[model samples]
Target: MAAFNLTPSDPSTFILNGIPGLEAAHIWISIPFSTFYVISLLGNFTILFVVSKEQTLHKPMFQLLCMLALTDIGMSSCVVPKALCIFWFRSKGITVDGCLTQLFFFNTAMTVESAILVTMAFDRYIAICDPLRYATILTNAQIAKLGLLGLIRAVLLVLPEPLLLRRLPFCPNRVIPHTYCEHMAVVKMSCGDTRVNRTYGLVTTFVVIMLDLTLIGLSYGLIIRAVLRISSKKAHRKALNTCTAHVCVMLMFYTPFLFSTLTHRYGQYIAAHVHILLANLYLLVPPMLNPIIYGVKTKELRDKVGKYTCRM
Candidate 1:
């Protein structure tokens, strides 16, 4: 155990546990995680390619979808391949700097995804509620600027995390009991006082993710109220239909996140494997499903995909 601790002469390295107690079954476990990784990679890449090429699909909603696809690709790329190396190749050694890099990118992608969803909700709000000004409001330039801001905000907010983490003194237990580097999971392994890490993590979640979710909820609230005033059921349905893909994505993103956070904080009585599994799912599920949800629900994307693939 002493060998794992940081000494004046020791190199900072971390051993990632593929599934802690389930090491013997890692070959089996990697199958599903790897399946989701491949699905998310191909699915999101297709969405990006399709939207970029289809002139008819050029709009605020589709633009936001592209941003989501980028984050999905990024987040999955940060964790998946290295995780496979651990599970399949039995190579779990990662430099502390390498682990921190993975953590930064993963968290940044998550924050940006949340912000993009909020922007998408706003886009839907205008298209459904204020059709006449939707163009003037979410112009291509404006949408591009919003997308850039989402990325900038995430980078700035998550930058401090790795820097702060680097300052901590890690104990001999340098083994992470999960596949990938998560913000809280890494901090929990430190022998140093983790109050700052945990508190800062909570504050950031509330400020960014919670606030984004709140705004998305408000946007939908207004959307529903506006949708309800229509005298015709057909109009109401049409207005609500535009938001179905985004709603499914929000559920896919938030449900796992909430469950993982709850398990991390309150599930001491729960098995470590359970917490680790939920944490992995929290990052994996959204990316894999977001593209499929949009591709299936949005007729424009679906037809464009079919058109593009048929040509190939």
Candidate 2:
């Protein structure tokens, strides 16, 4: 049997590229990617593990942290393992169904991650803005409902990509120039007119990203406003201090994402490898850094981590 079933009506397989025009460096490059992937897996897993075991940590904020950790694990696992296989073992063949599966899960995880961040921003907003009513506002049930809603929104928005792609006919050279099957990367392989795919993708991305960022920005704006009202220097410092981890995570998550989106839309003059690297970073950086940021900046988590590690 052929490695890739080349059929215009229904291509059976797709090829993945480690990094376009840089196959020689793929092995060496996998070093850092592998490190990020491992750190991401372990760090996020640790967050989940510690949060789940500690009754004291079962609050709304920590619950959101668990959700974020789960999203990170899902997103990272979707990309890095397949990428590692490409870089290490030279296994780049992915079936159509498999590619679509990867596409959906990756997008779903990303959507969930974005939505969770917005919720985290809201959590911070309440924590800073209305401490007296925080508990009343964000009960445990409400937090879980928000998490579930995020998953639902992600599923509904991302469902069209694969379904649309599956309807189109794929031409020959069904090679994806990136490590994993991205929605657009896969869509561009179709011989059919992908106006619907392109339009929906652009709209969905802009709507989700812009709306999330706008809400996050509005949230911090309010947070800053509330923080400014603190009468004491220590109180002001404390308020800002609590938000430092969230702010760091937000930057860590959005900066790479913004760069990648801009590069995709306008940085055509830049190297293909640059686009590939940025895209991977858009997913990998946050997962690897969010836990570390929280661990360092959140005193509760830091103290808990210290105690846990000391016991180990």
Candidate 3:
């Protein structure tokens, strides 16, 4: 799947040797990514397995975790393989169509992840703020509906990105700066006036991320209010403990996201490497840390994972 407009010169057309120190940097990229992939795979897979095999773990929070693990797998799938191939295997050039496809999935996974994180927050809010009705509020049927809705919204919300890219013309200089087909990176290559692309991209980013943040914040705010109302220090501690994983996970995603955007505009190529480093870590770190955080902090997931693993 070559770019419709650009002819491939060679596999090395986009290799990093041209950049100063990039040849040496490739080794750094490859090693860290390789290690992260292993950890992410193991952690996410264990979470998925734990949630799937144990009926006790089938609550709304774990349900969201499973959705998150699935999204993490998709997110890693979108970037890691191509990145590894580029750095380790020296397979650099990707067709424009291939780039578009990758961008779509990456964007989709990102949007889906934001929604999943929000859903998890809502789940926590319900459990903490309305303990008695938690079961009724987050029944299996309701969780399933949320899962399906998240998937649908993920794919549907980001549809405009790739569609808009398809209409834009790229007259020349089809080489993408980064290894994978990031939306902004791909847009920057367009020969056409990219005001529309920039508008859509920035708007899309703000809309999705801000919306997710608002909902998550609201849920957390209510949870905090409810926790404060409860006088037991032990109960307050327990409630905060449940939220720790989600809070860490949200910060992990949002901080790098905002930094990457800032780096994109102000930092240019110099920030690009940093953005790539952050993006890779964003996908790998959260997934790797998520299950560990949950298993360590949430006793039920931990015990279920241990019990299921022992059985296997």
Candidate 4:
């Protein structure tokens, strides 16, 4: 066992972690991940292309969908490329600076995705529950404003994570257990007191997930009530149908997220890896499903995407 000194007087050193003696590292993981990455990229790109080419999709709902696609593209690109490199080349080494950069962008993109989903829910709520005010309430200007706010929130939330991590004194172990640089993963490697970082992380998690979940619940609750108030059975069914896809996406996106956070904190090593897997699902599943979900569920989007593709 080796001990690392963490003092200004001594030179800094880092310890890398890996299996003690593995003859051949496995390469199989990259196959599925790479396939998923390609599909994710093509899927998200198609959504962006469809939305951009169709002038009719220039509404608030589609605008938010476009933003969601962008966020998913960024999230997958940030993690999967590096992960594939590691798995294919058997090169797990990463510079401290590189690690920090990875954490920053990953965090930012993930935060932005969460915010965009919430905004999308709000857009849907207004469209269904308050049809008369939908146009005025979610004007193009307002949609742009929401997008801008998502960007700003992402930037602001991540600024403190790196700043906080940079200040922590590191243990010699430089290797992260998982593939990517998660905020809590880095924080746990610190030799110094990490109470502040943990507190901040918890607070941010609550603000992002709990608050967003509460709002989503409220928005849907109102939507359900609105649906019930519609006297016509056909109209009620249609309104509920419009929300079905969104509800599915929301459950898939948030349930895994919450489970990951909770299990990662208190569960065993295997549990932690399962949580990591779930977290990846959050990034990949919603993006892959969004366009398909919206396409089948919303006739407007399906028709618009079809018309735009026909022009090509």
Candidate 5:
């Protein structure tokens, strides 16, 4: 192999390690990963298509669901195909600019997804607690504004990452031990002082996760209080039932995300493959499961999906 003439200022390319200590198993790992990707594509696209065609489903809640589906598609698409290529073809080289682009889109999808979850929680809260005003508050115009704001917020939050990265001097060792261009993973390859990069990354994570979780929790707290005031047990069950899918989806997204984040930052004692696997799962599992959670818990969507499948 010829010597790699890499410059700290403008490194030509970085190699992605599919999974450290598991190179022999990359093909095996891609099996499940590819399965998840396919399921995510089918499930989320089905949600988008069904919701779009069904007139009765034209509402704030379903509109938000479509947004979530878009993000799910984006999140999985951002990483999975590239990962599959690495596993199957041993094609791991990624240019610095390409890596930065991937990092931006991946993080933007993640942040926007968080925002959408918070919006979904609020939607449930309003529908249950203030049914009369739900339509007024979450109007079509309002929903459009919310979606625009979410995209704007996501862009602003992630835009700094690529900019910060460009200024850094990367080390000669340009291999990242993961499937995709995760923000921190790319940052670690830099030989320059990375305090700003790390600090900003943590700040973005805190803003997206902690702030969103607090809002979701508050929405549910009010929802519970409102539900309790309903004297009938049947009414209580009915009110809570609507939120079950959202809650399940929330858990599916955050649990793995928190675990992966903490493990990456603090779990040095853990095995490398374990960290890589969880990181991949953090991106894969939620998208694959979100539509299924909604389909099983939501009667209208389920019926529509069944009818649509029968026609095809």
Candidate 6:
């Protein structure tokens, strides 16, 4: 047998381990994964189509919802196809460049989604707390600016991750034990010191999660206070009802996110397959659920979707 010649400096490809110890079940696993991907695509596209077509749904709230739907679609699309390929075809080999590209886009989508949620929270705050200035505060131009800012921020923050990974000399063991090239997993495969990589990753995670969640919480707190100030019970219900979809979406996004983040960092005792499974679910579940949540909770969107289905 010829001696292995690949070195740390010239590592070419990484093999993704899709749910280790469950190799026989991969094809079965692809069933639900593909199902979720289909649902996410159909649901989010329907939202975009409905929002664009309807005149009355063109408000600031729906505008932000459109942004959120776009982010969800991007986020799921970034990972699911490669994952399905892994599970169905056993095509787990990904070039270094390809893995880095996946890392950049996936992280970018996640960061942008967080920013979009924060913006949504702010929209709700303005609509309920200061209804008079909602129009002036979040004009079409302003919403466009906010969306652009989010994309820029996400790109800037995630750009460094892939660049940093590119500089690292990866070890010969290139098998990553997850469906996708998650930042920390790829970092762990590096032969060089990854202190900077780990530090920067943690710092960026904190910057995005801490800042965004704090702002969201503060917005909701003020929203609650304002709702309480409304003397009529009917007014209170009306104001809170508008926030239901957003609140549910936020919870769905953050709960799995925080879990996956914490487990990646500190869950040494946890099973690897469990961690990987949840990591996959973290990407899959939110996109699948966001449109459904909004469709059920928002009357205008629900009614339009009902009409569209009936026509179909």
Q: How well is each residue in 159-254 modelled by candidate 2, as lDDT tens digits? A: 998999899988887888999998778877888999999889889988999999999999999998988888898998988888888888888877
Error of 6 at 258 (Å): 1.2
lDDT digits (tens) for residues 135-199 of candidate 5: 89998778878988989999999999999999999998888999999988998899999999999
The parts of candidate 1 lying over 4 Å away from their true place are 1-10
Error of 6 at 204 (Å): 0.4
Pairs in steric clash, model 6: none
Candidate 3 residue 69 C-alpha distance from true site, Å? 0.5
Q: Estimate each model's TM-score.
A: 0.94, 0.95, 0.91, 0.88, 0.96, 0.96
- How many backbone clashes does every candidate have? 0, 0, 1, 0, 0, 0
Off by over 4 Å in 3: 1-21, 268-270
After superposition, which runs of candidate 2 have C-alpha atoms over 4 Å from their true positions?
1-10
TM-score of decoy 2: 0.95
lDDT of candidate 4 over 140-164, digit per residue (tens): 8998998899889888988798889
lDDT of 6 by residue, 147-215 (tens): 999999999999999999999988988888899999999999998999999999999999899999999
Instruction: Name the regions of candidate 6 deviating beyond 4 angstroms.
Output: 1-10
Model 2 residue 44 CA deviation (Å) reads 1.1
Candidate 1 TM-score versus the reference: 0.94
Error of 2 at 254 (Å): 1.8
Candidate 4 matches the true fold with a TM-score of 0.88
Residues 138-220 of candidate 3: C-alpha lDDT, one tens digit per residue: 88889888878877887887888888888887645556657677778777766788888888888878888888899998998
How far off is residue 156 in model 4, in Å?
1.6
